[model samples]
Target: MHGTSPPESQRNLSRGLILLLATACGAMVANLYYAQTLIDTIGPEIGLSPGVAGAITTLTQLGYGAGLALFVPLGDLFENKRLALLSTAGAILGCLGIAASNGPVSFLAASLITGICATGAQVVLPLASHLAVKERQGRVIGTIMSGLLFGIMLARPVASFLADAISWRAVFLLSAGLMAAIGIALWFVCPTRKPETKLGYGAILGSVWGQLRRHRALRLRAFYQAMLFAAFNLFWTAAPLELLRNFDFTQQQVAWFALAGAGGALAAPLAGSLADRGLMWWTSFGALLMLTLSFIGADVAVAATSVAAFVIAAILIDTGVQLNQITGQKIIFALSSDARARVNAAYMTVMFVVGASGSLIGSATFEHGGWTLSALTGAAIGGIALVIFLLFDRGASDPD
Candidate 1:
């Protein structure tokens, strides 16, 4: 198919269609993360403590990892539209459960289900990849990823605002409604393509495990992303409480911090564009330098009462993390287009698992040592990642 005659429409979707698909992926994936905003609200509503409530996030991450390992490869074995539609439906059901949950157990279970269903976003990306030509794939993927990053970045503030205004439960219901709408749209609009392989689910899933063993690039990139994500998670998971406890900021104020990070996410397209220009080395160097600077800036911000410093730190941290993720995806997706979903599964599974661990470590450290210690730990990890990258044997960050 790579060298075969190309269809005109499949050559590239119109800009509008690409944006629409990207937005859809963002909306669908947002269901998995909206809980972060609602967690504080919903926890109090259900009488759960902050520590216990965090399990919702942990469970969701674990579920996402599991889905990446087991469910995403189905994209190669089933129709993309069918898989996305079904996943959307499942997400809607999961959101409904979240909206109705009355206890910790129910919330955790609902989150796990939503995490699994959110693989729709992963499936859709590879499908979009297949639709685009090679030359434009970077830009196309970058455009779609912008939506995904926005979904993740905006979820915190949006969820916090919605939870503060209406009810936490209402947020999940709104997401469920959106999921239904997307599912309906896909049912009618998405192309009907058949499976690439006739492998049974057993074989398909086993192949995921097999890929981990066989693909050196996949393993390396996954581990790298995992380390970076751990640091990213540590900061995000701990910062809110640090602000609330030390600076006496409101939830709304903390939510606003996410906006600054989103500004950073906007750099993703620029990073991709740079990669296309064969300047990824410079781009990465700059991004990591920004991250280091942010840590220094954060230290000053903590010492003073200036929110501006925190804002600057957020932008730098997010920029570095977003760039790393885009670069990682670009490399892994290039490995084997046929197994893009599996590759994504492997990458995301490891990334999120480490992210969960980071959150746990951050929270635990914060409980004992406070924000400074947590921040210090995060900075150390980020520095280690930088060292690893510098010492890495690959000529470029991408080891294709």
Candidate 2:
């Protein structure tokens, strides 16, 4: 799979190609999250109840879930790069719809569109894996994955700042422009990689069910990711409210707190390198344990007024979350080189949907039981994730 010492020029070109692909994927994904930073302003602007405001995130998650089931599998039958390009074009239109919206209903409709189209990132990940040399696969994939993590984590703060200075709708306008640019870049830059299988659309959809039955690793990885993402989502979903009520925090301040999680994004490359070094299982196990411990710090942060505790917990939780994500992807990419995109689509679709539900549940729990309830619930979920990891034999199947 690896070319032994390809010409330096070829290696350099591969690196450049990976970077461009990452950048395009990042920009497209940022569209799905733009509404998150603007949810508060959008709710009041559109006269939505607080609970309904939470639906903004929920709706996007549901749309992504639908896309994962409906669109991601097309990577196996359709041209992968073309799918990415078309998805980006669709995302641009979705962002425009959001920017033009005059009410919550319109915004909700647009949000769903954005989520459906934003699965471009899922398609692109497999494209990256396919492009990588075998020996450098994990590190190369990790480098690109880091770029993606940056967009997902930082888009909120960046969008929030933009919305503060401009209108919330302006955030969507900027995203629309970025998506247009990405679609064009992808058309020029992405390598043409077609599917090897001749599975018809009906056969492709049926394959997912067959894959589920045959691939226990896929199921375990998805469930593990689901629980871990739920923990991560629960914190981000509920922490802002806790800060606003107890610490008297402002939205900008809370947005800035996200920077603490950027440290976690930086951990992706490191985790990927570890996976390349043949420590994938250990890295995953250790990261899961660390995430479980972070829940303790998370509980402590609940009532504490000290900035130190909150910051520390944020770093631990975010780092653990990002580590789990990178490690899980490394595992899946190794597990199914033949159908990497569908594998990722399975894991991410379930995990993200879990994340979306965790966010909604976090809010409802906070409303009823306050920060304590939210923190404990998150910690409990993390603990359960660790248990599942422990029960599964990491060596049950050989890495592809």
Candidate 3:
């Protein structure tokens, strides 16, 4: 805990409490993704043409970026439990709005709202960090993050299956009901921990940039993850198209592939443990190296037309990304306690804002030269991050 103790309800953070918070993160983050896998079907049903169909996912992502900029920083100023729970309530409304959408305009608007509310996951993270003891914070956060990763990995497949069984609307409808239950349960289960910051909302928002500028470690950590995340996004965005085109994969099969790739999230807790043991540099180096190499392996696997190799590449790619993510988050969170949310918001905003570009780059590269070009491009990105780390971060003294 900080100088002030955590609220009574969260003093212990037993297995059950951790599980609930992790589940909450998973469920909230999942909302940002369901629309992504169902774009083709959703567009056709809602009168959105094929050309503009990408807007459905794009607006959702943009909304999430907005929420991170606007709402996440508030976590540093407000009651943690109330802020997270309120965000959850908003997400439930957003989900229901999305479920009821009948047109392109309505669907897109609802998607944006859902994206904004999905920052509940971001809020949950620093809250968990605040509640956990200092020594074990990394491990606890990594476990919670594993749930977030699992949600991302599972959302596409779940959406595809649910849409296949019922309709595209069921995904959001079901999410709404699940969020409703989670929100209600958390109201009783969560303890109140008010933030110590005295800054008003405007000042808090302004300080986000200040923190980024003040902390060299935060910049490098964010940069490392941003690069890896860009590569991660690049691989995922193009991989599905490649599979469908070259491997003759059905939507359901792509879903399964993604589900299998999710196995990498299991390593997040291990990464956290390594960070706790003070092997941050080694962990990050290995992760970046693996990420860089995985793309090359993916290219080879594609050339051989071997699904097994591709699966291996998928696992390595995901593992590298998650491993680096856990390390990066642990580093930044340690940079400041009082401004954890603001610093977190700043770090994440950088990565996500930058990482969003990878999707566009991936789609374009894949379209032009197919998987060969796209995979190589991803490799180049990873290689850059690796070089930067080896040169600057490897033997350099960590800033306080």
Candidate 4:
């Protein structure tokens, strides 16, 4: 649609391209989360107060939200390959800044930049959606999303393990090197996509609000996803603290716990397949219910100090979040062929901002009332999301 180019048949995504996109998504999104588990170590080194240290995760999320608003929409305004490369390059610089930081202020600033640049993952998702045929869109998006979800789930363990083996600074240095490698590979292998939209930058930005107003399904799906993401963030942010305080687990043990949570990545493809079959309503409902139950399970696990129970809860929580996310994305990407990037930007911006607040709330709740309060808060939020979905979203139509 952008210009004279390869026919749709030729442009159909190859296996290699899908793998590349998946890897790119994983690598880029990993940057926003590596610091989450390292906060304990980093805080002492930088003389950060507990309250201020908690802000490390929050600031990264806020930067991601800002990038979703300010940078992700550029996917529609510029060629996809160039846009992705630029973001990745910025991430490399941010990672390097983080590695070299000598104080909390510098570290925090670098984290913000790293989060902002990680929007490259967002760019890759829409580009993948745009490349696939309509009938196979859900499957394609699901596969790529599996990689993104795995990236998110694995970042903590990888960061924690690396931090224990070396130092927190080495984690950032390693990430910077990985970002550079991925950027170079993408430059050579990724397809070029010039979006057909002719709107100026201001016009593109202005259109986001109009797009939201026009699509009731987009609004509903976005709200549901935001709530789910908040719950997701709340659990992961607090779990590490609980393990350390209650179980006396070392960083390596926490890393193993995070590795267990990666089991949830399996749900992404399964949810995508269900969505393709027009089962999003039931799947989403079940996912929300599972999310609620998972938190309850977590509270019980913490009370009894049962590692097995906690592991099960982690799996269920991660699975529920991944299911809802893929299902929601399947619906939103189908709303308009030409406006996928803008619609995605609007949806993700809302989700990340709310999710960031959830991290802050979880940290404070854990500090004051311990894991029980944090778990209950997550359960309550999940219940609220379920109510909203049942009352207003039950009648939502499947994507055409």
Candidate 5:
């Protein structure tokens, strides 16, 4: 798996390598989330009113979407290890810049750059797929996804606690260091995967839209995950607000409540295994149902002001979201063997760009109507996805 390695250079992809790749994916994707839970604390310090703080979250997601379209497809045309390192380098700079930001514009710009460069996770995942044997594709993707999901889950709690213990700026500063280490590790350990595609950069970019339009499964899965991810973002963005406002929870308490969602990371490996066993549809159905139920339960918890119930809802919602995401990734990654990165870019761009709106939507809804309204919006999103799954998914093992 070097500069001159063939397509089969790492067909039997080792566990240690998988763990390293998984760690890299998790650490990079975690940048998209550290801002989410800290919106309350970050907004004021950077001179943004509460009304506009969520903009940072949206900007970060938008950055990721921009990267998916603008950079991730390069994984197919360039050496994956070097490309990921380049993206990582950019993310490191973004993190460092955020740690030093003094105004709203500077902070927002840094957030966007961090989000965009965070697509190093995107490159790394496809790189893992390049090495994975056919039978192990789902499992490898799932294992890596577990790390990404855990990173998503862990980031909020970690940020909350870090902000509580030291300062919000420390989170990004620490992350900058982590990204540098991971980038170096990737450069040294990961085998170089030069995509076999002969397509030029412009040609690959052009093929992205066609990839989305051409693949039925890709479209369906993108839509499904988009809805669920919106719910996921809305919950994380709004839940802390409710905690601080209604329950008078301290930042440490909020961290503990947020930590509940970390349990959801377990769903990734399990969902991947189920998809490998041809139960993707059932797994997706269950995931959607769980999400709807979790939202319903969260509404109840918010109304009752019960932290325990809120914790349960957090775990369930996060699990449901991860389950559907892993299933969708397994499906889409199988859609185009030759165009994995482009198809992945298309699938993720649709998901994150649309899903990013959840922050704004949730913030406004919660401000006017409270968590009850927020929960209703999330439930409605989850319910719609469930209906679409029922109508279109049937009992099929895989998409056509």
Candidate 6:
């Protein structure tokens, strides 16, 4: 009775709404990643040097980090349906700008805007968690997150396939159209969720730091996920380059490799079920171990030029990262019922900022020392995260 609550009927998450949220999350989040696999193709066309082309992925992720900081906190200040739709509309405009850009500067700017607006996916996640009952929150979040992970994993291959069939610009145009349709559909389907707080915009935004300070579990879980995500981004960002250069893979073949990586999305619901059973500690430990080992395996495969080894490593890495992310969200979402959005904003803003740096670091490492160095860097980060979890995460437990 103390927190914001809709009517009892409105609290139940209908199957239709669940599916709609999943689809919308997938479509919106896909915009941030489509440029990643196309950097090679787009760079020559736009007259960008290799270094500048590589920065495209980093810039897009940095834009998403900015959006998470600035816009995601608004979920605590406005009706969620309207907030989601507004962000979606911005994503459409950004997509169109990306499609229409004729040069490197314009393209990079549009990429940033596209990344910024893609925070709609972040907003949708917290809204879904808020709508779910306490007992079912992990499952609901996992189901929605499965869709998001799929989008992230599949976007590269889909974009690569499209780029091969049509042109790189066409990928953004198609995404713009898809986002517009999803936005319109979501406008009609999502329930209104009005926050009960009377805090001003400045106060709500200012409260994020306070929330971080107050929640030690939030900080630990966020740091754990951030390190896993950084490694995750490092692998995917450099993988395309490795496949194309070392393996002499065509874009379509690289797409198939990405398709293989999508298998990792399967870990989300399992992680949710594990958290529900109070197995969060073991799950988190296993995920970190898998991530570190996967990178080590990937380094060996890259050195030996073994495609099968690379594919296996990709699956393990993706699965490990997804497991850590779902487990972390389950813990953090239970921290504060009233301020879930702000808590999530704080959590993800830190994660994405670190992840954006991973992209830059991955690119630079690959450019200088090739895939071997990149894989070692990722493995080392994963190892550090595992150590932090063991040494510092004493209070990180599943909520009773």
Give the winner by TM-score.
3
List TM-scores for all candidates, in order: 0.90, 0.91, 0.96, 0.93, 0.91, 0.93
Ranked by lDDT, top first: 3, 6, 4, 5, 2, 1
lDDT, candidate 5, residue 160? Answer: 78
Whole-model lDDT per candidate: 0.76, 0.77, 0.88, 0.87, 0.86, 0.87
- Residue 176, candidate 5: Cα error in Å is 1.5
Error of 6 at 160 (Å): 1.5
Model 1, range 156-255, lDDT digits (tens) per residue? Answer: 7888888888988888999999888877877776655455676788888878767778777677667767877787778887888788998898888888
Report lDDT (Cα) of residue 323, candidate 3: 91
- Model 6, residue 295: displacement in angstroms? 1.6
Could you give candidate 5's per-residue lDDT for residues 1-400 as a string of tens digits? 4432345656788898898889889899999888876888888888999989868977897798889998998877888888888988999999998999999999999999998998989988987877887677788898999998888778878987887789999999999999889888887878887767788889999999999889878888899999998999899878989998889988788788777768888878888788788788888989999999999999998888788889889999999988888888888887777788898999888998788778777888899999999999999999999998889865433643
Clashing pairs in 5: none
Q: Model 4: per-residue lDDT, tens digit, 55-158?
A: 78777877888899989988878888898999899899999998898888998899899989999999999988888876677777888998998888889899
Between candidates 2 and 3, the TM-score winner: 3
74 in model 2: Cα distance from truth in Å?
Answer: 0.7
Task: Flag regions of model 1 displaced more than 4 Å.
Answer: 1-8, 44-52, 102-107, 396-400
TM-score of 2: 0.91
- How do these models rank on TM-score, best leading? 3, 4, 6, 5, 2, 1
User: How many backbone overlaps does candidate 1 show?
Assistant: 0
Measured with C-alpha atoms, the lDDT of residue 296 in candidate 2 is: 76
Which segments of candidate 3 are over 4 A away from where they belong? 1-11, 394-400
Better of 5 and 6 by lDDT: 6
Q: How well is each residue in 1-400 modelled by candidate 6, as lDDT tens digits?
A: 2245666666789878887888788888898889877888899888789977877877787788888888998988888888899989989988899888888899889888888888999999988888887667777787788889998888988998898899988999999898888888887878788888889989998998888899999988888888988899899879888999989998789899999989999888888888877788999999999999999999999889899999999999999988888888999888887787899999998888777677778889999999999999999999999999999988675565
Choose 2 or 3, whichever is better by lDDT: 3
The clash count of every prediction, one per candidate, is 0, 0, 0, 0, 0, 0
